[model samples]
Target: MKKIFSFLFLQFFVFSIVFCQNQKIDGHPAWIMQGNIYEVNIRQFTEEGTLNAFAKHLDRIKKMGVQTIWFMPINPISVVDRKGSLGSYYAVANYNTVNPEYGTMEDFKNVVKKIHKLGMKVIIDWVPNHTGCDHPWLDSHPDFFVKDSTGKPASMFDWTDTKQLNYKNSEMQDSMIAAMKYWIKKTDIDGYRVDVAWNISGNFWKKCIPQLKKIKNVFMLAEGDSSYLPKSGFDAVYPWHMFHVMEKIAKGTLNAWAIDSIRKQTEKRYPANTIQMYFTSNHDENSWNKADYETFPGAVHAPFAVLTQTMAKTVPLIYGGQEEPVLRPLKFFDKDPMEWGKYKRAKFYQTLLELRKRNIALAPNASFKKISVGNDKAVYAFVREKAGKKILVILNFSATEQNITIKDKTLHGTANNIFMGSTETLSSKKWKMEPWGYAVYEY
Candidate 1:
């Protein structure tokens, strides 16, 4: 009886191990440590709008400690029912072909090589939920598309420019997976930023991720915020809630305590291993809204950038023109090139990026403890620590300078101030914070 029980126990243990392995996030064979991601809007990145033109900036990006580069759709756009003059990149005409407007296939390969040469991974946006009407599959395999009750091809949501895909069809899933694999095989690109990932069924991602993993280790990022996506196969999801919280704070609708509440809520919702991609502004936010500066009024730019870097379970993202403090809404379907110029904000980002790379405590999963929220509605204070290293960050969300008193002794120590570039000694006692200012100190 004892021998039989031992055999059964062993069998159950083996099954449990296999089950856990199969459920791993994004089908990543291994876990990632601290990583910084950069978004590339290839169409608007340069005047030439070619892979070669973007290649020139690779060295600079590498220097910024960027671990991954996410390119917006490189696929050819549908000319039929185009949104604008240039058409939306999301309107996919051909999944496999590169947009002639951006560059040739060879040019994309060279760009991928250059990115890999710098020891950084590249991911392209995958719009799996929908495709442009001009997609060849529509003609070849009409059954691959979703049909409405009227027996017409369905246009899911208000996306009249894009036709929804039918994930129920195994062939559609296979074709999408094949296209993903093609990019990996041909360009050696690392992974994908699945657009509107929530719109697709989790089962499809589960089936697709494992296949992609067979090619190479890939880091999958979902544009939507779904915990199950990470649990099933994605490495990270957007912190849409955090962005909303920040925007509220910027608009004076919420106080600093709201930020703390949101952080705590996020911590409770996500797993310890899952990464939240935090950003001040991305292409959508910049293009739709008036950029971060306009959206986040009275918020000091440098400190806001620093806050994202120090936040827990975060992978900070830099949109194309953020470093330059570009305020204009970039033309989505037109040749609206960024007017590159020297800005103090650029220096601020450089310093923060350097600090983030050097500080192990700032790495994802390092301690992110909210120390105190000042009685004053505008002040938010937190401490991040790892091993023996600790950083205390205090930000005054309001425009007017305010005095703050630190009642916590743990924060009282000799530390380097990232913004002022000096050493500050804090005590268990009180200190005043400047308006729209932040103090990042390490001990």
Candidate 2:
């Protein structure tokens, strides 16, 4: 009995040690806590539309304070049921190979090396829920995909070019994970932005994510808003609810108070430490719904953009050509490069991004308190505080000027008006803000 007790105690000790190690790996990487991500649409970003061409702009992007670069799918596109001239980036034909159109695998490796050399991280878009019909798996492992009445692999939800993956098949799940692993091992990428992460089963993420982490402390961002995406091991999830609310607010269909409801809903739905990726526009919104210039047109876009950058548990995304203020819908499957302007919004984004890097108040885990400005309907105000640092953000969302007062006596102090580059005394005085005006203060 004594010997048996000792053996059991030793087993328990080993289990405890293993559990603690798993806890650390499961949490998000520390580097992303205060970082900003920039999405790179390779095909439309430059006229050449190649990795080598995009590499030339690294210094310019790095100067904009972008911490991470997320390149849209780099894999070869399937030609079997291709969408258009070039084809959708999501319709991936081969996972391990780089699209020759974008450049050879060596060219991609060089670009990744250049990005890292500039002290920025890299993440590639990964499509695990489905594959293009031209993928070898469709012919070699027929059972790896879902079957239709005709006994051939069926497409996923009108995406005729792509075939849905069979998650129930254990071998298929294993292959999908192996493909994901190959990229990290070969390219030394920092993480992945998983496409249609909600379509895959929870069990697969439960089984797949930890294995990927074992290889490297990779940051995973899901393109879905499902709560399980976070619980299953994703570091961040898409803010679909907040994105729609911002659009409605811009259209005058919703007021500033609507943001509060979404925040409350977000708080209750996801687990703690779950980051939300906030953005004004992305690939889907740019191609299908139109860019931010249409969604949050003119001066109306700035206030919402400010909110995304300063909000709690948020890592904001700036889509490619947003700095150029690209206004038209980018063709999804064709070659329509951005007409680069004078980078009209570069200074504006740089100020916000720099503040995020220097201010502890803007940290992902900071404490946020909503402040009731005079007009709750047209104006939104909030304070983020952390480690004895505080930042106050106020925005006028209406078409007319707003005269508002900060009633919190505790907030009256000497502060720096971040955008104006001036130090001012904050008091219980009424502040006049022009239409779509924004103010950020650090005390």
Best by lDDT: 2
Query: So what's the TM-score on candidate 1?
Result: 0.90
lDDT digits (tens) for residues 209-323 of candidate 2: 9999998778899999999999999999999999999999898899989999999999999997889999999999999997697988989899999999999989999998999
**Taking the tens digit of each residue's C-alpha lDDT, what string does model 1 give over 1-443?**
99999999999999875564344332343324456778999888888887788888888777766777999999999988788788887989988889998889999998888887777778899899889978888899888899989876789777788888999999999999999999889888878999989888889988999899777777889988877788768888999998888877777788877877787787788767788888888989988887586876434555566678778878788887787767778888777877665644666677767777777777777887776646558877788788787778888877777777777876666778876888878776666667788877777
lDDT of 1: 0.80
Candidate 1 regions with alpha-carbon error over 4 angstroms: 1-32
Question: Which pairs clash in the backbone of model 1?
Answer: 26-233, 26-234, 401-435, 405-430
Candidate 1 has its poorest 10 consecutive residues by lDDT at 22-31
* Best TM-score among the predictions, by candidate number: 2
Clashing pairs in 2: none
Candidate 2: segments with Cα more than 4 A from true spot: 1-26
Candidate lDDT (C-alpha), each? 0.80, 0.91
Candidate 2, number of clashes: 0
> What is the lDDT for 399 in model 1?
72
